[model samples]
Target: MSQHHAPRQYLNWLASLGLLLLLGLGVELLLQQYGLRQQQAEQQRLLAHANEVRAVLLGELNATLHLATGLASYIPARQGRIDTAELEPWLQGLFQQGRYIRNIGLAPDNRIDFLYPLSGNEAALGLYYPDLPKQWPTIQRIIASAQPRLDGPLQLVQGGRGLIYRVPVFLADQRYWGLISTVIDFDRLFAEVEAVARQRGLAIALLPLDAAQQLALTSTPDTELHLPVFLAGANWQLQARLLNPQPPLLRGLRLVGWGLALAVSALIGMALHSQQRKTSLLLALSQSQRDFLQAFELAPQGMALLDAQGRLLAVNQALCRLLQQSPTQLLQRSVMQLCVPAEREQLQVRLATLRFGHNDSWFLQLLDGQQQQIAVECSAAILGQLGSASEVRILHVQDMRERLRLQRLQSEFTASVSHELRTPLTAIAGALGLVNGGALGEVPAAMRELLQIAQANSQRLQELINDLLDMEKLLAGKMRFEAREQPLWSLLQEAVLHNQPYAAQHQVQLQLLGPPCQVAVTVDGQRLAQVLANLLSNAAKFSPPGSSVEVAAVVQGGHVRVSVRDQGPGIGENFRARIFSKFTQADASDCRQKGGTGLGLAISKELIERMHGRIGFDSVEGQGSTFWFELPISVTKPQDAST
Candidate 1:
């Protein structure tokens, strides 16, 4: 090879190495950011999972405490001896309901007097609570503090690790009356948490703070995360570790970087060989520019490049055709010059407000070469970084003429159809009512039922027409709401009373739960009553004979939750998605049997929403369903009304 060729080859090699090094550094930085983000995400996930487990454990513990506290309140304190034989039935039933409780013991004077479900806890029977040296301190604390205490994950007398919850019983005047100890199996309690950790490929350990190091239970792990577990006054540590740690994100990044570097090196070698043969680099540069121009011109959308000062830099063929102007005529002109005179100021204001790398859009009228105005949606985006001299902006224009025209046509059609149906529907309903009321003449006995049926059908048809009109008005934002602050209890009672006649027809009673309270909410009284009536009518219709429909008003945070609960065949999953949609029904056969326009819920939803409230339901296929709505509480407090 010639000396000149050798020097060029060496220079190419050095350039390729520098490019590879830069690529490596870039990949490393990206991988560092990715690793940091992954660590944060992992920590968040661990905390969420740990809290979930904590909640479950707390729920179980609270249930036992509730039962024990309730039982303690029931048992009377006596001077001599207390008979626990008669209490066995209740204790046994309570013990059966617990998920992890192995035994429940009632100790009077710190000595076990009664223990239920003694099969696996026989050794714990008739034992003195304070005699157990290992757990005596925890028990003594419960007695001294007169509060419930949690003990163990310790060695139980019956063998195996279990937690004991001790609730100190107290009588009148702070007299201590024995204690109730609910023993929960540690292994069973953590079964769900362990299973979840296993599924997530995490190693977990539970270490009691009071226990020796040798007693710690763990899944063999690598990198560990420690979280504190505090339950019922017992402090414990929950350690989550990775069983099979993953290689850092950097590993894959490095692999990709090396592969790209190799490809780039090969490309550099090829380019160098081409350079030696074809030494005119200027021709290659010109060819690349031509390729870019071809791509820009062939794009479907109009493209206009504007400098930072908003003067046009380049215009593509599409843009030139859109503007009906030649490249020579439009070159170096202000982009704002294309807009009509009235829109130029607005365009200048929008451009001034735009930040680099952000987009802004507005509607404007543009003038063609012939000076005719055309409607267009203009979206502008600033390109490149702030304070860069090379930075420019791009404008994308779309013609909105067709879309606006179609929207106008749709609105006109809906309004006209609704108006046309209203007059005829009112006439039909009035005529049917007159005929059914015998204003036309006395009807024969055989035709009476048929007349009644016709009247009902006509009423249903009228309801459908009304529903359609209301829906249209709601969608068009033409409906008016007169809202006021009213007594929530009064509203609930009125709705219940109104629905009583309907409920009686179905032999279903409407019972209101909870005492009357002084709670007020701002709402359109008539609209809210209508919503409640619709819900009640549904509940009564679906309930079986002698079944009671429960109406409740619960005070939730910032709102009052009103619900209508019915014991009926609950909603099917298939119908749930469109439950609030117009013409939706749980069963198509229901329209015939239950007699509805299938628009009650849809209309009710609209009415509630107009009053700024939310409507929803909870259902189990076989159990029952509860349809509810919540309205924001009124700022004013009202006087309590008697039930």
Candidate 2:
């Protein structure tokens, strides 16, 4: 060969080598970017799973903690006395409702005086806190602070690992009564959370922040995410990691990219390689679509996709089974067609609004294929851009039959239990009354004091049962009202007089401020009196010693507003919203300092509303509170005016 021709051929080979190197660099960068995206997606998935497990863990733990608070509340309400006959049923009811409790024990003077569900927990019945040197300091700290604390996932005397929630019971005068201990089944609670994590291919570890070493409930040595779980005044760290940390598809893509870069050195193979890459992309897209379809089909809840007009675009087997219809029958049909006629028009309007991006949820009745009405809760959400042809909405339907059934059963059970409790309580109160009154014979002074305490608690228990029955009836819409025009002034006077004794007991005085006005209201006299009594008693209970609760009535805008004002610590901003919620107190300490079942205000609200009145309150944290109610004035008849 000529020397110049050989040099030109070598130059061409050099140019081809440079081009191959450039292609290899570009492919490597793209592969790295893809791997980064995969890692990000995996991290997000791990975080979501960790959050779900944390929520479940907190929910169960908080629910269990409330049981301890409830039992502690009982002691203060009874003036630091425990009646085994009455306490047994109360504890039993609480135990039945709690999902993870192993046992509930009441310790008077730091010795276990009573334990519910005594079968497996007999060994722990008489255990004293002072005997357990390891736990005595914690108990002392809790009692000294007068707060509830969570302790342990430690070994129990009953031969299992459990968590202990200890609540200190204080009497009305700030005397230390004892402690209430609730043992929670640690294995049962963590088992549920772990099961949920496992389903998502996750491993979780729960570490207590206070521990000297990292002690995990479940071990995940290589954690990718850390979340804080604050429950029952204890700080815990939840660490989570994906079980399959490496992505096989990403590794394969890296190998394939390098191989393709090398093949690109040959110019003739470029077009063929491009065509093969497009085919592979299409196959990947198809597989993704199949995976989505599988997930949609297997979802447990009834789900459907609908167009802007609410016509069914697609549905899952769950929806088909829920409606008792075939896929062919449901497809392309308007969702409103399945709803009862009374609700169809309203539902259609809501659907139209939802299409404009106002997502909503509502409860409605649907007609099955067999023409039976089924109650369901429906939630809707928009999927795409508003006003676009591609826009669709997804509807999630949950059957409410089981929920409704459970509600009915709960109401029936509450009513039955209240009735059963009332009978025995009434007899106990009557017998104690006779003994304390010396009707049975002359009683010793010391014995009389005990009998009087017993009688007072029995009465308190009876009132609580009555409140429970009234609340149940109100919720069930079974309460009957006998509304009649009554003189408002007379009602106010009677309430003040009735609550006078209770106010005296608290060392607070009751007074009427405004002059009596001739006002008549349409109301059930019995119910109105109950409302007034509740208000007056609450005012007296919270007022400072020697302070006065003032009751006043004034006419405003054709309604008479009666208010009860008190000069006390008033209400805290955070607790104001839940003051009327059943079974809620400002704090666990409030239950001890101020004795109440937390049902008075709630019951009063229900009664006032049923009688066509509105109830509200105004308060400042350090100043005081004024609770008021307004009712429309009854129109006086000519005959009554003449009289």
Best prediction by TM-score? 2
Q: Per-residue lDDT tens digits of candidate 2, residues 245-315?
A: 75534344445455565546645577779989999999997897799679879999899988888989889
TM-score of 1: 0.51
lDDT, model 2, position 418: 96
Task: List, residue by residue over 511-590, the lDDT tens digit for candidate 1.
Answer: 98878757888888887887888899999998889999999988888888898999999999999999999887787883
Q: For model 2, state the Cα shift of residue 634 in Å.
A: 3.4
Off by over 4 Å in 1: 1-102, 106-114, 128-136, 143-149, 153-162, 167-180, 184-232, 236-455, 474-499, 506-595, 598-643
**Cα RMSD, each candidate:** 11.4, 19.1
Clashing pairs in 1: none
Task: Score each candidate by Cα lDDT.
Answer: 0.78, 0.85
Scored against the true structure, residue 232 in model 2 reaches a CA lDDT of: 64
